[model samples]
Structure formats: C-alpha cells, structure tokens
Target: MKFTCEKSILQEGISTAQKAVTGKSTMPILNGILIKAKNNEITLIGSDIDLSIETKIKAEIIEEGNIVIDARLFGEIIRKLPNDVVSINTIENNSIEILCQKSRFTLIHMNGEDFPLLPSINENMIFSVPQRILRNMIKSTIFATAQDETRPILTGVLFEINNNNLNLVALDGYRLAVRSENLSTDNVISAVIPGKTLSEVSKILEEDDENVNITFTPNHILFNLGYTKIISRLLEGEFIRYNSIIPEEYNLKVIAKRGDLLHCIERASLMAKDGNTNLIKLSMEEENMIITSNSQLGMVREELNIILQGQSLQIAFNSKYLIDVLKIMEEEEIVMEFSSSVSPCVIRNKEINNCTYLVLPVRLLNS
Candidate 1:
C-alpha cells in the first residue's frame, strides 16, 4: 500500500484506531494496525478480537493495497514526525517505508489476510444521537461500573432505549447511577456494552457538533462517527433488576447545595481512608444536617444547614461513592432521599430532571 497524507490527519487516525490494539495478545497480528489504501482513502483498523476500531481518512493513493504494521511503532513514529506531508509505501518484500522531508524509516509489514475479520453491521435499525449527550452519559455512569471479572455483566454499562427515551445505567454493587434523556427515536432495545470499550470510544470522539449513529444486534454493537466506526461484542447475561432497587418512597428528604455537599463528603472521606470501608455518618437534627466520619487515624465532623422535610433520620454510607456522583453533577442543588439507615440513599439533581444516584449504605459495624 502506498499513500501520501498530511501528518496531522494521519496521526489522529492512527491514534484513534490504536486504542483497540492489545499489547500482550497471544496472536502477534493483533498487535498490528491494518492499513488499507484505495479510492483516495486510507482505512486503518485495530482489534483485540472482542473490540475493533476502523477509521477512513482522505489520502492521495499512488497504489491501492493493504498491509499490517506494528501499532505501537507506527503510532510513535507518526507522533514524532514533522507536521509536513508524509509518504508511506509498502514494497513486494513486505517492508513498509515512511518518508517525510529527509527522515525515513522502514518497518516490517505482515500480510493483511491473516488479520481477523471485523463484524459487518447493517445500516438497518440505526439511530442517531448527539455525540455530546452520549459522551456525557458515559462519563456520568461508566465510572460506577464494576471492575471485577467474576460477573462479567457488571463490568459493562446497560444501555436501554424505549419510548423515545435513552437510559444509561451502571452499577458496581455498592452504588448505581442512572441517567435518562429524551431522544428522537421510538425504537426499544437494550445492550450491555463493556466499560473498557466505551472508554476507548470516548477517546476517539472529538469535540464536534455532529451526531453519531449507533446500531446494535444480538451479539454486537456498532458506533459510526464521521469516518470512524467501532464494533464491540456484547456481554451475554441478564443485568440486575435495577428498578427494584430504587425506593418508591422516602422517610427523609434533604435539599442541599451540590458544591457544599460534595466538599463535605470529600473531606469526611479522609478519615475513612484508614479502612477499606469509607463510611460516613449522616444525621438530621432540626434544620441542619450533620456529616461525620470516624476511623483509627482521625475523625471529621461538619454541619450544613439544609432545606429538609419529613421525619428526622440518621444513615451511614461509603463517602467515596457519594463523592463520585457529586463530581458529575451539574445542578446547583440536589434532593437526597433516604428510606432508612440500611436502605439506599437517592440523589437527584434538580436542574438535570432525569438523573439519579442510588448509594447503598455501609452498615455500622457496631450496630
């Protein structure tokens, strides 16, 4: 394959595709990025079997061919190359040569035929969504996904679309985050997308005003954004019935400034660092709310006047989980609903309208 392309554009394409390349794969070809040149375009692909990323960029094609080059080396070389135009050519001996100005480098190339085939996604059942909304949803919930591999389904984010609403749910047993938005589609479908794949997709998505088209099947999910398309394998399992976890009513409700509550919880978490249980105590007394954390190292106690109603109650929770949700909150104030000391604490952003956080309390050891 021979192509001459602008270094900046080429670098972006290589960097995006390389996100799927596995460094320690048993198959050596999986570590390489496939390059295909044809029709004045260069297509770059990288895969680790479960996830694949492909991008097509405009290039002046001198010869239409394909080859595989080491992803790591290719990325490094392209990143360090001068901003001038770059010329790439693959010879019959399976050697790829890169030239820019007076700098030249030769890399060993592998036959493209040996690379694994990526799944072909049909255009049917495809729906478009604002990239910003998708990115925000992922950012708000992906962090709560479980990192454990024991229950593979927990390691992914549950995407449910129904009745013209797009719902993104993620949980790590200890806490759960759910966000919903009104999308322009009525198609109903659900898919469990691995957290790792969503993270890689987030990186390739640029800051733009364009929308991305997403397609899903029984076994695979595809995302098409501009010239890039990402295909990821879907996890096979039933996600927890998250609706059952949400309390239908609350015994106590407290409204507080998001910033103030976030700071208080963060400071309280410092004392909880002494133990794996980052527990913080919450008590409602009259017109104020008390937040405290005690551990072997130290203790933190603070009070914030809040707009509260209903019966007074006390609860304990993992402060880290609350702080994580706080970091993603955009509203100035939030309503926190509590059912009981042992029940989950629900957080709702007033301005956001459709986002909620449910954090299961950490039982007091001495209770």
Candidate 2:
C-alpha cells in the first residue's frame, strides 16, 4: 500500500484505532494496525478479539493495497514527524518505508489478510443519541461497575431503553448508580456493555451535541460515527433486579449544599483513612449535621448547616464511597434520604430525579 497524508490527520486516526490494540495478545498480528489504502482514503483497524475500532481519513492514494503495521511504532512516528505530509509505501521483502521531510524509516509489515474481521451488525435495531449525552451517561455510572469478577454481569453497565426513556444502571454490590435520559425513538434495547469498553468509547467521543449512531445485536454492540466505528462484545447473563433493591421512600431526609457536605466528609476522611475501617460517622441533629472520624492517631469533627425533615438520624459510611459520588456530581445542592442508619443512603439531584445514587452505610457498633 502507498499513501500520503497530513501528519495531524494520520495521527488522529492512528491514535483512535490503537485504543483496541492490546500488546499482550498471543497472535502478534492483533497488536498491529491493519491499514487499507483505497479510494483516496486510508482505513485503520485495531482489534483485541472482544473489542475493535476502525477509523478512516482522507489521503492521496498512489497505490491501492493493504498492510499491517505496528500500531505503537506507527503512532510514534507520525506524532513526531514535522508538520508536513507523510508518505508510506510497501517496500520489497515484507517491509514498509515511512518518509516525512528529512526523516525516513523502514519497518517490517504483516499481511493484512491474516487480521481478524470485524463483526457485521445490521442497522435494524439501532438508535441515535447525542455524543455529549452518551459521554455524560457513561461517566455518571461507569464508576459504580463492579471491580471484582465474582459476578461477571455486574462488571458491565446495564443499558435499558423503553417507552422513550434510556437508563444506565451500575452497581458494585456496595453502591448503585442510575442515570436516565429522554429519547426520541420508539425502539427498545436491553444489553449489558462491559465497563472497559464504555470507558474507552467515552474517551473517543467528543463532548458535542452531534449524534452518534448505536446498533445492538444479541452478542455485540456497535457504535458508529461518520468516520469511525467501535464494536464490542456484549456480556452474556442476567443482570440483578436493581429496581426491587432500591427503596421508594425514606423516613428521614437531609438537604445540604453539595460542596459543604463534600468538604466536610473529605476532611473527616483524613482521620478515617488512618483508621482500620475508614469509617466516618454523621450525626444529624435538629438544624445541622456533624461529621466525625476517629483513629488511634487522631480524630476530627466537622459541622455543616442542613435542612432536615421527617426525623433526626445518625449514620456511618465509608468515606471513599461518598467521595466518589460527590466528586462527579454537577449540582449545587444535594438531597440525602434514609429510612434508618442500617438502610441504604439515597442521594439525588436537588431539582431533578433523573440521577440517583445509593450507598450502603457501614454498620456502627454503637448504633
């Protein structure tokens, strides 16, 4: 294959496709990028069996052919090249030459025919969502996915779309997160996307209002942009019935500024981290809330003004769990609800119910 393209354009396409290349693959070809030059366009593909990414960029094609080049080496070369057009040509003896300005290098190339093919997904079961919205949805819930593989399904995010509403749900047994958004389609989709795949997809998606097309199959999901596409395998199993686990009402509710509550917990977490259990206690009095943490080395107390309703309560929780949710929240104020100290703590946006967070409190011996 022979092609000439601007360095920036080539670098972006290479970087995007390289996301799927894992160097640990047993098949050496899987660690390289499959490059196809034809029709004034250069196509780059990277895959690691379960995930694949393909991207295309316009280039001046002198000869239409295909070759596989090392993804890491090609990316580094293109990125370091001067701000000029780069030329790549297949040389004799299974090698390719790269040239830009005064720099030139030759590298061994693999036959593109040996590369695995990406799955073909039909367009029947498809939906369109804005890129920015999809990115936000992934960010809001991906953190809650289970890190351990004891239950494989919990390591993925549950995507459910029905009745013109899309919901993303994730839980790690200890905490749960749900993010919902309105849709303009009538199609229904239910699938569990691996958290690792969503994490990579979010990085490629631009924070823009432009739509990204999504197509789902029984065993795989496809994300199709105009110039790029991502294909990932779907996890096979039934997800937990999350709806039944979440409580519908609470006997105690506390409304406080998000920043104030977050800062208080963070300060208390210092002492909690010094302790064995990393526990922080909260005392909800009539008009204010007090947070305290104690360790062998020291102890700390923080007080914040809050509006409490229903009943006075005291609770304990893992400081890191609360911090995880608080750092990502985009609201000025937050609402915390509880039925009892042993019950799960529910958090929500001050104005909307579109987002929900549930953190199981650490049982205090004194409670």
Candidate 3:
C-alpha cells in the first residue's frame, strides 16, 4: 500500500490499534498491524484473538493496496518522524519504505491475507450511549472486578440493560460497586465484559458528548466510536446474583464530608500498611467518628465530625478498599450505612442513588 498522511493523525491511528497487538503471541502475524489503503482512507487493524481494535484516518492514496507491518517498529517510526507529512510505499519482496523529511527506512512486511478476519456484527441488537457517560460508568465499577481467574465471570463487569435504565455491576468478593444511568431504550440485555477490555476502551474514549454505538451477540461485544471500533470476547458464565446481596435496611448511618473522611483514612492507613491485615477501625460515638489503626510498627488515631443517625457502632475494614471508592467519588459529602460490624458497609452518593459501593468489614478480634 502507498499513502501519504499527516504524521500526527497517522500516529494516533497506529497508537490506538496497537493496543490489541500481543507481544508474546506465538503467531508472528498477530504482532503486526494490518494496513489497508483505499479511496483516500487508511484503515489500521490489530488483534490478539480475544480483542481487536481498528481505526481509520484520511490519507492521500497513491496506490490502493494492503499490507501488514510490525506494529512496534511502525509505531515508533511514525512517532519519531521529523516532518509533519509522511509517505509510505510498498516495495518489492514484501517490504515497506517509510519516508519523512530527510529520513527514510525500509522494513519487512507480512501479507495482509494471512491476518484473521474481524467478526462482522449486525446492527440488530445495538444501543447508543454518550461516550463520557459510558466512560464514567466503566471507571466507577471496573476497579472492583476480580483479578483472579478462578471464577472467570467475576473478572468481568456485568452490564444489564432494562428498559431505560442501564446498570453496571462489579465485585471482587470483598467489595461490590454498582453504577446506574438512564438510557433512551426499552430493550433488555445483559453481558459480561472483561475488565481488561473495558480498561483499554476507557483509555481510548474521549470525554465528550458524542455517543458510542454498542452491539453484542452471544459471544462477543462491539463498541463503535467515530472512526474507531473495538471487539472483545464475552465471558461465558452466570454472574453472581448481585441484587440478592444488597441489604434493604441499615441500623446505623453516618454522614461525613468526603474530603475529611478520605484524609483521615489515608492518615490511618499509613500505620495499617505495615500490618499483615491492613485493617482500619471506625467507631461512631455521639457526634464524632474515631478512625484508628494499630500495627506492629505504630498506631494512628484521628477524629472527624459527622452527623450520626440510628445506633452507634464500630466497624473495621481494609483501608485500601475504602480509599479506592473514595478517590473516584466526586461528591462533597457521602453517606455510610452499617447494619452491624460483621455485615457489609454501604457507601452511597447523597444527591442520587446512581452509585453505590458495598464493602465487607473485617471482624475485629476483641469485638
């Protein structure tokens, strides 16, 4: 293929597609990027069996053809090009020549025919969501997905669409995160999207008002955003019944400033990190909440003013778990509900119930 394009545009397309290239793949062609040039457009594709990414950019096509080039080498060359405009031409003997400014280089190319075909998704089961909103939803719950592969379904986030409401749920046994939003659809659908795939999609998505089109079948899910598309395999298994686990009532509730609680937990976590359990204790007494952590190395204690309701109680939890949810929250104040020290502690947004986080408290030996 022969094409001339602006360096920045070409670099972006290459970088986006290269996310799917696997460095340790047994097949040599999977490590390369397929480039197809036709009708003033260049399409770049990269795949690692389970995940694939494709992006297109406007280019000046001199000779319409297709070829596969080493993704790592081609991306580096385009990124380091000295000139704004770059020209790429296919040479004899399965090779490509790249030219920009006064620099030129020739690299071996693979036959594009050997590349696997990307799955064709029909427009039958499709939904549209704002890119910014979808990104936020993924960010809010993707962290709670389990890293262990023993229960493969937990490694993915559960996406459930019922009528106009869309809910995203994720849990790693210790904590569960749920984010819900309203959509303009009445269709019902559910799928388990791997966390790794969602993480990559989040990075590529822009914070804009543009809508992203999503389509899914029984085994795969497709995301289309402008000239970019991502296809990922769906995890096969039944997700845990998350609704049955959420408690309906609470015996204690504490309302505190998110910033103040975050700071206190962070300070207490310093000493807790040295211990094997990494536990931080929370005690609600009268109008103040005491946060403390005791470790073999040291101890930390802090008090914060809070509005307490119901009964007073004490609970212990993993400091990292609380920090994970607090760091991503945007609200000024948050509500924490507890049924008992042994039961799960629920944190929620005060303005709306769009986001909810459930963290299981650790059992204190003395209590």
Give the TM-score comparing model 2 with the true structure, all chains together.
0.98
How many residue pairs of model 3 clash at the backbone? Answer: 0
> What's model 3's lDDT at 358?
94
- Expressed as tens digits, the lDDT of each residue in 228-343 for candidate 3 is 99999999999998988889799998999999999999999999987457799999978999999988877899999999998999999999999999987889999999999999
Question: What TM-score would each prediction reach against the true structure?
Answer: 0.97, 0.98, 0.98
The C-alpha RMSD of each candidate to the native structure, in angstroms, is: 1.2, 1.0, 1.0
lDDT of 3: 0.92
Give me the displacement of residue 65 in model 3, in angstroms: 1.2
Stretches > 4 Å off in candidate 2: none
* Candidate 2 residue-wise lDDT at 364: 75
Clash counts per candidate, in order, are 0, 0, 0
lDDT score, candidate 1, position 298: 73
lDDT of 2 by residue, 277-323 (tens): 77999999888999999998889999999999988888999998999
